[model samples]
Target: MSVKSYRQALNEALHQEMARDPHVIVIGEDIAGGAGASGQQDAWGGAFGVTKGLLGAFGPARVRDTPISESAFVGAAVGAAATGLRPVAEIMFVDFLGVCFDQIFNQAAKFRYMFGGKAVTPFVLRATFGAGTRSASQHSQALYPIFTHIPGLKVVIPSSPYDAKGLLTQAIRDNDPVIFLENKLLYDTVGEVPDGPYVIPFGEANILREGSDVTIIAFGRMVHIAMDAANALAKEGIDCTVIDPRTTSPLDEDTILESAEETGRVVIVDEANPRCGMAADVSSIIAEKAFGALKAPIMKVTAPHTPVPYAPNLEAAYLPDATRVAAAARAAFTYGK
Candidate 1:
């Protein structure tokens, strides 16, 4: 019943999870900052200061500070996870994924499948993603698609503070490896999050707003945009339903197909690029399962295929905003109606 920033929610979840389980360890580059430095050992508390107070409470043993080497530290996290530790490693930016993709996709993600369901790698890789902070091409990217493309990995994009807390907790407890994406732009964003421990089951689509005319399916921060668009559409006497499938890997196909069938109109708002991404994936799911119910072709509101631009104006235009999502939903509703 209290409001908290998205970052605080994440911090709280990590704190609570660590308190609940001794095996849950946090390893990352300067996560506790000043790791081996003389100036205040916990000075940095992470690049953006998300883990500020963690070192003081949990100490350096549980809250580790790793070298700049992503492969070594991240690979160590993966190896530790297989050996009975629930390691939550922060990759800082999703862009840095290239350095450690092999460990995730080939090792952690494939452990269970490769071993014929004998292995269980309970690990979480949290990274900041999306464009809005003018972090340029390398630091800012909506790279969920790359993770989504891989098998045995559960991908999560939490749009709000509440979802961030719940989904991250769920990811930590799950048996398989999970890639949790936090939109760098939404760190300061505030929302209500429960204080106690709770876990949101994956593969379940949350229908935030119900409507009769159109179904707007979204993920991560796009879910917030779709909700904004739904509110704007209401003024025009057009009702819209917004659905967020918290986890992309175990996608809730049943909820999506049902929503598509019920509304007979679908608009997918994804922060990722338009090509072979979440947008295309969800559109195809509805197209294949509920094609007959569609009164019009499915619509997708997504970023251009180009890499996230650095310029403020270009970045603003490149990222799909509330207006774009609303317009897309309006078009989908009108075209079908």
Candidate 2:
């Protein structure tokens, strides 16, 4: 195991996976940086430099650079996956998903069911999400919830470098189409990740730092925010258990329900909009299943139902910070006292 940044872990995962499987190919805009340019090739690596060294490792055939078209490239990726090629397609930004919604939701997502369990779309859609980078509303949005609503798509949001490598490895190996989301803000965050390739199965929630007072469930970059809140709460005599439900589609309902029942208070933190987001979804699950074991009302700390603001101040106010999360957890912990 070695200390690696989140970006390094993702890059390592792609490198290891492509080396392991020749059939695995990468296609996206500027993936090879300067594919046809006269200057230094593989310069950009990708929009965020996650695919930097891939062009040098694997030739141009496997590490491809597609035109500036999400609909065209994403649709092509769907077809490629259905035809036996395990393609890893990048969307650059999660906001561009609307351009190829049909290919993803209607085509790739339902291939297995549509073909009576014979089809296997072993494809992974990598996109950057979340706020706090000042990338503005257009380039910044935590849109994983939109993908999670789809039936056949598996949504993954890793909080740390360790989870990023393991979950991405698992997504590449899985037969179904996986929507692996990476928060733009987390790319620089550092954590320990295994040296070689490894896979972490889906639907398993990591109960990070257990406590008896409150249960905190978060995903993506919001997990860090929730952990900070949990740590702050601990100092004030309120212990909180932090749970990261790594994958949203194959959600570990059992672990969440168990944790909620154990603590009897849940503070779900999500960076996406409050309405119809993961926070609301988990809130519903706990309310219905673990309603009887409740000590205080479920608190959902999420962004407002508005587009991400471009201004730094507005964006900071829009995000669910540790203070807000701590306040919610404190409310739950001190209910009826």
Candidate 3:
């Protein structure tokens, strides 16, 4: 085991996977950096430097830098996956999925089912998401829920460096199209990770904290917020259970339902908009499956249905925080009393 940043863990996962299988290739803009520049090559290593050092190890063939067109490269990745390669294509920001939605949702996601289960699209579409960096509405939307809505696509949102490494390795190895959403705010966050590759199976909800009072379900960066809230609530004698549903699509409904039944109260924290987001989806699930276990109403703490503001203060307020989560949990605790 070794302490590593989320960025480093992702880089290591890609490196290990590429070394393990020659067919695993990386394609994205500025991934190798300084591609045609006069200065040093392999400079940028991606927008946040997550792909740094990969270019030097894998070379231009495996660690490829493509044009700024997301549609073209994402389509190419889908094609490559259908043939034989396991392509890990970085879509830059989750907000940029607009240009390549057809390639992802229509083609890549449907190929296996559309072709009588014969195609194995082992393609990983990686992108940075969340709203903390003040990159404004265009670049900072938490759009994992959109991808999760698709049937054939698997969506992964890793909260910690350890989870990032494990979940990414699983996504790369899985014989299906996976949308791996990384929280940009968590790039520098450090945690203990294994030195070698490991896979955190999809659809398993990780229980970060265990308590009997209430269950706090959170996703992506919101998982950290839920942890902070759980810790604060513990100080107030309001113990809480925190769950990180690592994958949103094949959501660990059993774990969530179990936790919700144990506590009889649920507070879902999601960075996406309140309408039809993961929070809403989880709430609906608990309501439909475990309605009899409820002692209080499910409280959903999420962003308003508006574009992410560019201003730092507004953006901070727009995103869900520990204080908000704690307050929601407290409300859930007191709702029926």
Candidate 4:
């Protein structure tokens, strides 16, 4: 294993997977670069450069550049997956999914069940999410909860480079439509990742830290914020456990319930709006199953039920941070004591 940024890890995963399986193909806007725009293969590499070097290795047939149309290309990817190829379609930003969501939720997500288990759509829809860099409301939003709400779509949100590479490999291999979201703030963060491709199974939560006072569950870049909160709380005598539910669809309810029962107080942190979001979903799960072990009402630290703001200060305030997470965890930690 070697240290790699989240972008490098994602690039490596695409390289390894395409080489291993000829059926794997990539279709996205400006992914393979384009004419008169840096003018060569792997030049642009999508909006964030995660798909860099794919064109040089896989060629045009496998690494394709589609027109600037989310609906057309995403629909094409779904159709391609249904026919035979395993297509990894990149949607630049998750906000653009509104244009092609039916293709994802209706067509790609329903093939296998509609065909009575004979059909398989091995499609991986990769998109960048989260609020940072002042992309404004149109570009920065956490929409994983909507994908998770869908019945057949498998949702993945990796918090680190190690998790990104392994979980992405797993998505490419899995025989179902997968929505893999990469947080915009996490692409530059570096971590140790294996050189060879690896797969981390779905429904497995990564317990970043173990403590007894309270359990903090988070998603995507929020996981790091939760980790920071845990470390800070440890100094104040409020030990905490941080869990990252890697795939929200096949959510590791077992791990979450076990941790909630063990601590008897739970705090869920989500970057999305609190209404009908991951925070609410997880809070409901804990309340429904682990209520008997609870020492206090379950707490959810999430963004306000509004769109992400454009101003830097408001944007910062709109997203959940370590201080807020620590505050929530501390509240839960000392509720009765």
Model 3 C-alpha lDDT versus the unseen true structure: 0.93
The alpha-carbon deviation from the true structure for residue 266 of candidate 1, after best TM-score superposition, in angstroms, is 0.7
Q: What is the per-residue lDDT of model 2 for residues 28-125, given as tens digits with 9 covering 90 to 100?
A: 99888433334676367999888888887887898889889999989988899999999999989999898899999999999999999999999899
Each candidate's number of clashing pairs is 0, 0, 0, 0
Candidate 1 local accuracy as lDDT?
Answer: 0.88
State, as a TM-score between 0 and 1, how close model 2 is to the true structure.
Answer: 0.98
TM-score of each: 0.96, 0.98, 0.98, 0.98
TM-score of 1: 0.96
lDDT of 3 by residue, 172-254 (tens): 99999999999998999999999988999999999999999999999999999999999999999999999999999889999
Better of 1 and 3 by TM-score: 3
Give each model's whole-structure lDDT: 0.88, 0.92, 0.93, 0.92
**TM-score result, candidate 4:** 0.98
List ranges where model 4 is wrong by over 4 Å: 34-42
| Superposition error at 223 for model 4 (Å) | 0.6
lDDT digits (tens) for residues 1-337 of candidate 4: 9999999999999999999999999999989853233455536878889888788777889988988999999999999999999999999999999999799999999999999999999999999998977999899999999999998899999999999999999999999999999999899999999999899999999999999999999999999999999999999998899999999999999999999999999999999988999999999999999999999889899999888899999999898999999988888888988
In candidate 4, what residue range of length 10 has the lowest lDDT sum?
Answer: 33-42
Considering summed lDDT, which 10 consecutive residues are worst modelled in model 2?
33-42
- Model 1 segments more than 4 A misplaced: 33-38
* Residue 267 CA displacement from its true place in model 4, Å: 0.5
lDDT (tens digit, per residue) of candidate 1 on 11-85: 989889999999999999878843343466647878877777777777779889887999998999999999999
